[model samples]
Target: MKYFMFLIFVLLFFDAKGQCCLHTDLSRKFDYKVIRLDHKDADGFARESKIIIELYKKSDKKLFQKIQFKTEGIGLSNVFSKCSDDRSYITGQNMKTEILDGDYGDIVIADFNFDGKEDFAIKYNIPADVGPEYCYFIQGDKGFKKDEYLSNQMLWFPWLINSKKHQLISIVSPNWGTRIYKFQYNVFSKKWRKIGNRFFRHDEGLDEELIRLKNI
Candidate 1:
């Protein structure tokens, strides 16, 4: 009886860690197909997940490249709130057809390097007082290569790209600061440069009355 009990416990543990659901984004606007496998607990909270992306030739749907990676899981509430209209949850024998609409899923598709090709960023962590952390994958001649600079330097804050200025603009709430990173290429050195600038809240003319004298 003890041996049987031990076996059951082991099964339960594996089940909790291995339970996964499927989400896909086959949007025609994108050149590649994206599949997201979310590994969740019994309560449906994802702790770890996998992403599979397949690049295909538009002419005949021929597979060009396949890319896969694993990253930290996203909360169920976050997924539902962001992708409720575009994603369909699937598990086991029950399969729901994925709706191909706007850019959905955990991945953010954009041209981070300003190379005219769409690159992607996947959320890997959510630090306290900061925000979500992302792993950037830039498109290359061979395939998507992980970009350490963007992944490490840029925290996933409320951000946008300024195409005219060739800059990445992000707002960090904790420090109430705005960061701008200008992207430039050097022909002689054959390297890229990211020049960053920070504008603190005080620089933006914060009201002195808002701060208490005791706190200051």
Candidate 2:
């Protein structure tokens, strides 16, 4: 799924690198390729193309295309007004956001609270006319409820993936000029805390990653 991003970034960059704006044709490699549609922001294209590719990959084609995208960390929005900083994790940066899972696009089905059955953490698209995207944690029965988070703009960009421990990891963006956020399962605490403010690829220990981010 991570490689899914290369589709938009690489594709778009390819076009930009071209001198004349000749009608760009998809130069097929026979093997699946990553193509980014634009330079500044490929959210619109990413949102659409990613779903088709992922759906085809999961249901019909290979689980992951020839060039598998290494899933990145989750980008979270700062939902709290009092919290300050005012930033939400951006999703489209690493991967695209669209509903390949039918109703849930960038969502994970798991027992986030650890009660057993399973809960959910999903990113929502603030209406096309609204501000940036927002993420929510829905507990059993209660369903999708809004929380005070980090993201303010309505870019609604996020990607959900099951990690090595079968834990759901999300690579999300809160707002413009912000890095990604990694939310990990605190086995002992039984809750999700934003780890490694803006992360790139997967890391074994979140604590170590956070320290690295801080040092940088």
Predicted candidate 1 versus true structure: per-residue lDDT over 1-216, tens digit per residue: 553354466445535443222123432323444445567778867766666666665455556677777765453424322332232111111114331211224456666666677666666665555455667777788777888766777656225465454556444445454333344444345345666554455435323322321132
lDDT scores in order: 0.50, 0.32
Error of 1 at 183 (Å): 5.3
lDDT of 1 at 144: 79
Residue 77 accuracy (lDDT) in model 1: 28
Local accuracy of candidate 2 as per-residue lDDT tens digits, 73-95:
22122111111112112212212
The most accurate candidate by TM-score is: 1
Task: Candidate 2: list runs displaced more than 4 Å.
Answer: 1-115, 121-132, 140-158, 163-168, 172-178, 199-216
Query: What's the alpha carbon RMSD for model 2?
Result: 15.8
Where does candidate 1 stray beyond 4 Å? Answer: 1-31, 40-45, 73-77, 80-105, 128-131, 157-160, 163-165, 175-194, 206-216
